[model samples]
Target: MARTSRAPRADAARNRDKLLAAAAKVFGERGLDAPLEEVARRAEVSIGTLYNHFPARRDLIDAIFPVRLAALEQVADAALAEADPWKGFVLFVEGLFALQARDRGLNDVLARRYPASPELSGACHRGFVHLVEIIERARGAGLREDFEAQDMAPLMWAMSQVIRETADVAPDAWRRFLAFHLDGLRAGAAGPLPAGPLTEEQARGRPGEPAGSPGR
Candidate 1:
């Protein structure tokens, strides 16, 4: 027998969730231009159903991109609540890497559009701040090397870049690379190029036009 869904309102919510799930898969494969009709088909709904939930392209993109950003906050909250800061930090890295792996296009899309949505960027910044606290506590406990709070953002961004690119490879391969960075470079806070702590003017994502070009 088919499993019964909830009341009418709850069933509507389930349909919304199904559409989003289908959209995530479709968008992950094709990026922002994934066909909404295919998404509706995958969700076993009509095109009208898809529009009923998300009427515009930006709305659909918002559903896919920023939702993961919000999920980052929840992961940060969970990890920070754990007993060991170092353990928490590891969880944070793994969670972030997993997010990128789910949709390889996500990093590129976010790198460009992160600045457009204050809420998405702010959530990421908050998550990084939470990680900074963890890093400081872990260093204070002598479990990790020293890193200034400002250094955290760039370092995290760099590591995120590495992980995003290396994602979908063998899991251990990425872990080994991360371990090298953590043990040799990041663990010591020593680098040829110094990055001061985050400033009031600087934001989380790297906001710049494409190389040698105006207006992308």
Candidate 2:
């Protein structure tokens, strides 16, 4: 007879929950590369228990970031639903930067690729598609004629850098930089450019590259 898998025991389930919660806390403070040992310690569990639950860092990351990824999609949806495309575009950009400013883990997630995690990779691709639609709508409404869908990734990458550098010292400083970038993105602000925007594949990064590659 074939054997069926049994559900986890109550204590084991509790330990799993603790580990996930601790991981969320640790990754929020540090980046996704934060130590798994720290997460185990924070959960008051042994490293063995954490490994039992997550098996690997990618597994832990895959478990912890879905909610944040969903939140980003919701922001995109909300912005897309706005009647004014310009307002929608602005809201999308501002919302993204605000989330990154607050969550270091999310900043890392947004700024990188995770090829090994299919769920996270799919979510990122979907988010990029949403951005493409949003940008198209904004352009249709006569905003940022020079802007391309691929430009969004580079912009977010730049903002992530600014957020990383200034977040501790001036948590809100990214806002000022974003505002300046927004100004430059305005319709009438278009001027002769030095070079064309990066291609979508280029903006999304090459395979096997580091997670937080600017292309991502």
Candidate 3:
């Protein structure tokens, strides 16, 4: 009787794994908004089974994305491990955009297409902590002093569009764009700009409020 009960539990676990794998493949190919039916189809599971594993679209995304995005932390650690701060910063930035270019689902996550996913939010917050260290280290080593962590918001948003627009037609187009941006970020490239950098709130998708303040 115990063996019989364990068999059912093991089967359920297998089904859940299949659903997650299918969802990752589907979402990576087609972005986060891809239909649930495709995930179920790819998993070779009934729609009921897929729903049993993940009741809502966000639930499926929450399960898959946080794990995938954990790779970002690995990238960050690699960057920090580099001997040269400027090189580390470049590695971090290039690594990030490379991941975005490769994965449609991650591109959507970086773009904040689904803001309601608490898992993704937590992942992003952790990424930002690494970004701050990367930015400051780079600044000390010839990155523009005035460039703030918040500036990464616009840079990411811009690159997100470039990746989307050029993914099929010119998959490496973002590389050229990134080269130009990296040059502009050098200390010698600094010049007076028309506007100031974004606030921390703005960087985090909550504009018009000071950092650490109430949300309303």
Candidate 4:
């Protein structure tokens, strides 16, 4: 007997898309531990349908990761186009952090594994290179201080680590933290950003911040 391939019904295609979108959100928030069955439920599909599309968890995760990267690239590219390099760098970092905060699973799982690989690291390196170019341009105009490109790489890595593992810190303090991080990189050699891998126990951010706290 010969193998027969069948085109999925139209409804099956819609269900597959819904599953991917919901799984992206669920996995982004909760990590890939989210059950496929649960994803199917959230997407209003049946488990059989999900399995039909994503046969394995890794398949789903790997697929979603690239899609997420594309979205981030678009946002960062727009931010990098700002006239002020300093402002552009700050906004780019801000957008980057927001994506991680909203999707801790991606930061914790995919990012940690990829950053250590040079080929994998290059994708992210582009973002930092773009940031450094902006900062240098700002400095040339005396709108910013002298900052090296190399500094932004580890700053980005450290900030992502801090955001991912330190869930105890209240969310509202992120902008203040970003400001603190950026301030150190400004023209004058300010002090250091606390070396991250900062556990929740380490951050002294406001506990249960008020509604109007900065960046809320």
Clashing pairs in 1: 150-197, 150-198
Candidate 4: tens digits of C-alpha lDDT, residues 1-216:
122333455667787789888888887766546567777889998888788887876566655665465556765677768877667767777787877777865664324532123433444444344654566666744333435554554555666656756645665456677778767666665445454333433221213322332110
Q: TM-scores of all models?
A: 0.63, 0.87, 0.90, 0.64
Error of 1 at 100 (Å): 2.7
Candidate 1, residues 21-133: lDDT per residue as tens digits?
89888867654555678889999999998888888655666666665666667777877897877677767766765665566446545444333456555545654557666
The true-versus-predicted C-alpha distance at residue 111 of model 3, in Å, is 1.0
Worst 10 residues of 2 by lDDT: 207-216
Q: Candidate 3, 166: how far from true, in Å?
A: 1.5
Off by over 4 Å in 3: 206-216
Name the weakest run of 10 consecutive residues (lDDT summed) in model 4.
Answer: 207-216
| Residue pairs of candidate 3 with colliding backbone atoms | none
lDDT of each: 0.62, 0.81, 0.85, 0.60
| Clash totals, every prediction | 2, 1, 0, 1
Residue 36 alpha-carbon offset, candidate 1, angstroms = 4.7
lDDT winner: 3
lDDT of 4: 0.60
RMSD of each: 6.1, 4.3, 5.3, 9.1
Ranking by TM-score: 3, 2, 4, 1
Model 1 is weakest, by summed lDDT over 10 consecutive residues, at: 207-216
Kindly report which residue stretches of model 4 are placed more than 4 angstroms away from their true locations once superposed: 1-8, 45-48, 113-129, 139-150, 166-169, 190-216
Pairwise TM-score winner, candidates 2 and 4: 2
